[model samples]
Target: MDEKVLLGHGSGGTMMRRIIDEVFFDAYGGEELAAGNDAADLPLPAEGERLAYSTDSFVVTPHFFPGGDIGHLAVCGTVNDVATSGAAPKYLSCGFILEEGFPMEDLKRICQSMADVAKEAGVRIVTGDTKVVNRGHGDGVYINTSGVGFIPAGRVLGGQYCKPGDKVLVSGTLGDHGITIMSCREELSFRADLKSDAAPLNHLIAEVLEAAPHTRCFRDPTRGGLASTLNELAEQSGVDMVVDEMNVPVKDAVRGACEMLGYDVFQVANEGKMVCVVPAEESELALEAMRANEYGTDAAIIGEVLPCPDDRSPRVSIRTGFGSMRILDMLVGEQLPRIC
Candidate 1:
């Protein structure tokens, strides 16, 4: 570890893992915290009870972007984290850090966005806090959200639950949110419409769980996109993953933008997407249920879990469109900074 922190520490890759293990976990970890799932599954005061809890901070630049703004991102980010643990997100608490001289109108717009998304997701913003910093000390605004949700009985989902023969599925297209932010940040002009796929995914996930009760795990591919998210799950489950590149969906506009900008769509960020793992036998049923939901119309089975090869660590590989296979590793550094 270095004497001070670097932006790479927040990139959700190797550095982030080191910092968590050496700093946060070293100082505050317990049995439950050490598990390091997206959300903490805590036992309620009453017997035979558990709840999912998660917190996240958003610092996306430009604040407002195509399809959604920071406010919408903040709510969906936390809600999806809790929901990924197979919980029904119910309540959230928001905290705001505002730079001095920030516009009141913009703040009102953000608050309204939060309210609207909360209502749509069936979650409530029950409490919050606000702080102000000097004009140059902070961005125009940064938002932190914490959420709690109830885990339904018989719903035990975690990355470690995956095993060989399980199938991998992704919700909708990739790189929409990241490409939208990149286009806005760089002021890139394109004829095709590009928008962030930012929306609450709790409802879509609920439908999938109902149809595929034997689902092994759920993960929202946020910071490091689908590649990193799948790699993490593969390592956690001690299994290898073989993904079909042709089956993975990427919007034409987004793909073009990524090519023009030298960005890998698989390594970009997404606000309203999830990677689901379920038994191979239930893959088709899970796909059907996901497609029935508005947010998951593009859901597809992209891969399958495989037993780890002898003398090698668990990893992820993609079968390219050209009949070649390549290893897909986690993002080494920040691809698009301030992306949620």
Candidate 2:
């Protein structure tokens, strides 16, 4: 534990447990995790509900960033994904792929961050696996997380559930995560501040579900951003989506960076925000609930779903402020490779 570690630390025996107990549980120990069971066996609320699950891997470069790191990213990313399904995220499983020469101090810091994030989200890392690859073959670290949550009996949400006249809402400003990482990596200096929008969204989702059960679907625009996520939902639901470029929120600093780097904000990634589709009647309620939360203070309605242009194929279109419209599609290639 002095410095960097070797492959043996990931053998799933004493070394691994030592790492877990000494660095992880030792810092975040509480009654919920003291038992050291293979998996957590906690009871759920008495309400009849079905479960929602999601998993994701984080390989963000520079490990740490202005607002988050791979450890927090691993927990918050999966929690947001599960929450987007309109369910209450409850438990998590974390798997680590570490490099042989990775620093033990960094590992401990990461685990501590993970533990804190799990506590904040009210989700426990009940089970996990770890492995080590040769220094040259692997990146510094990679984390894969699986999450499970229970969707209450009357809750309904999905990409395919969208119908014409359904309104689209965004939780907050866009492209913060992508811009922050790029700035940190390229060492670019800017007059305005830019930080990653990385945080757990389950609490906001809970409020939305409570206020707007008519919401048809929820999507976190991660790797592909808002444009790609909308295209995905359009295709899945066989509907067309129309978004107003003026209505979508983007911070001035993030917008400046995107313009300078020739990066399309619509295709940039986000960690803390989400896109919600809801019946027109519930759009106001959803917006109010999202705006009341810290993560979504700038929430706004950006678009609506309509009948697909071609029978069953869904398409996404954007309306620019200049009085013209254009089709928006999935991103062709990576805007910023190695970006989480």
Candidate 3:
């Protein structure tokens, strides 16, 4: 029989220690978890007055998807969230909810991924907990991550900071993560050459901020994808926004898949990509910064914020290659559930 998780593993006794030592600690160890304390003792940023803290949970179905698994998504999701605020992520806490009989080997794989990704992003998995539920009561594994970083003084970024003349940019191709998840589902099994764009983007965002200090904001288009992200920003700033459909960078394979699946490419979720808004003059600077990073080679300026004409409510519009215009709106209902 395959070695599998058992409820006893979470009993906080010898079995729990075995799981923590043989699985989690063996995969990733640091000062925090090694201390064996109830909570991690952390230090404050040396200089920055503002701190960025974010938390998120991952429960994507088919946890093992192309290009990324739940472990990668869990770490990247929280790290990216902190980085979007122009902070360099420093620490992370991960919690796992695992099902009984879940393969121990698979758990090891996920834990190792979390370690490797956290290392690359320069963030430490400082603390964590593991719990196993009875069979059929929980998914194979669900990860929750919380991250923290320090934002330098005088740095302010948010959807509300958007201004007309600010240029909108994306780190790379869109729809890769969403399409990959959809294609790999057993029921559909839609074949495509797509992989989840899940990645840690702290370094990439750092580079962008370095090149363009006047950046208005950064947002990861995860759940609602590009359309919803832009619309949210437009509404926040009370500014209309416009984009040329052709300017958005999307992989041909993803586009083809979306066409076949009757999905709007703009509304698909992404894991590793970020949408940046910068002042017009700093647009090229930001784009160049993104291109310099491995994760942002395909970065492009996709659109610009516009003054709301006649003081109308903020809205986002896209100009098609065919010369027609359409309002870009947030997804009303679920469009691909359980997609990270």
Candidate with the larger lDDT of 1 and 2: 2
RMSD of 1: 10.7
What is each predicted model's overall lDDT from 0 to 1?
0.85, 0.88, 0.91
What's the ranking of the predictions by TM-score, best on top? 3, 2, 1
Residue-level lDDT of model 1, residues 187-265, one tens digit each, is 8886248989999999988999989989998999988999999999999989999999999999999889889989888
lDDT of 3 by residue, 1-340 (tens): 2399999888899999899989999988887888999899999966746899999999998889879899999999999999999888999998999999999999999999999999999999888888888988988899999999989888899989999899999999999999899988844545546789999999999899999999999999999999999999998999999988999999988899899889999999999999999999999999999999999999999999999977578889999999899999899899999997
Better of 2 and 3 by lDDT: 3
Q: Can you give the lDDT of residue 274 in candidate 2?
A: 89
User: Residue 96, candidate 2: how far off, in angstroms?
Assistant: 1.0
lDDT per residue for candidate 2 within 61-103, as digits (tens), equals 9899988899999999999999988788988888889898899
What is the TM-score of each predicted model, taking all chains together? 0.86, 0.95, 0.97
**Candidate 2 regions off by >4 Å?**
28-39, 42-47
lDDT preference between candidates 1 and 3, better one: 3
Clashes of 1: 0
